[model samples]
Target: MSSAAIFVNIFALSCLVISLIKDRAKTKQSLLVAVKSFFRILPIVLIIIIFIGLLLGFVPLDLISKTMGEQAGFGGVILIASVGAILHIPALIAFPLAASLLKGGASVAAVAAFITTLTMIGTVTLPLEIKELGKKMALLRNGVSFIFAIIIALIMGMML
Candidate 1:
């Protein structure tokens, strides 16, 4: 295992032990809550994993590379960014998907664009945003976010 992973595990255990020592009942309660949350999220995690597996299994590597690799350039980045903006998935789940894309030959820029846009803009929640913040504000925010997302991805591409 990686030293980083080992360190994280040790740190977590240490924290849990400390919590237990400080307040046994509270620690037990916290553990129960954490376990319940884990179970609640387990289905979503499994579904995403299966979806990713299917994506990698069915989609050709060449296609993914061609669409998001170095060859695709700015246009490809923009395309992925748009998709990201439209997707409603949680960022925690998206990280694994992004990692898989990276391993599958997606360009750094495309992946960056995807993640930045995904987190920054939310088309799925736009209706709520509009209702809460007004239409003009929501639209302006999304438009500006889209532009910045593209810029961020391009910069990452250049640096990496």
Candidate 2:
């Protein structure tokens, strides 16, 4: 595992210990909730992993590079960003997928845009967001997020 993963695990362990000491019942309840959430999301996680594996295994590297490479330019970034916004994969899986694409010759801008839109713009949850926050607010938030995602991707491409 990466150092960051190790550090996060250690930190979480420390927090659990402290929580247990302060309130055993609450800590136990929190642990149960965490486990339940994990199980609830496990199927989707597995599906995402399998899909990513299949994508990497079956898709030609040359095709991926040709579509998402430096030559693909801003159009490629927009295309990937749109895909990211449409797909409902969890952010935890999205990062590694983005990394794999980057390794396979995808442009930094495209990968960045994909990650940004995947995390920030939730097209899958739009109906619920509109129900909860009203249509205007939901549309504004998603629209501005999409714009900002593109801007951030462009900036990252320039820097990196």
lDDT of 2 by residue, 47-147 (tens): 87787788788998888888988889999999999999999988887887898798778999999999999999999899999999999999999999999
TM-score, per-candidate, Cα-based:
0.83, 0.91
Q: Tell me, by lDDT, which candidate is best.
A: 1
Q: Highest TM-score: give the candidate number.
A: 2
Query: Distance from true position, residue 79, model 2, in Å?
Result: 0.4
For candidate 2, which ten residues in a row score worst on lDDT?
44-53
Native-referenced Cα lDDT, model 1: 0.94
lDDT of 1 by residue, 96-160 (tens): 89988988889999999999999999988999999999999999999999999999999999999
For every candidate structure, what is the RMSD over all alpha carbons to the true structure, in angstroms? 2.4, 1.5
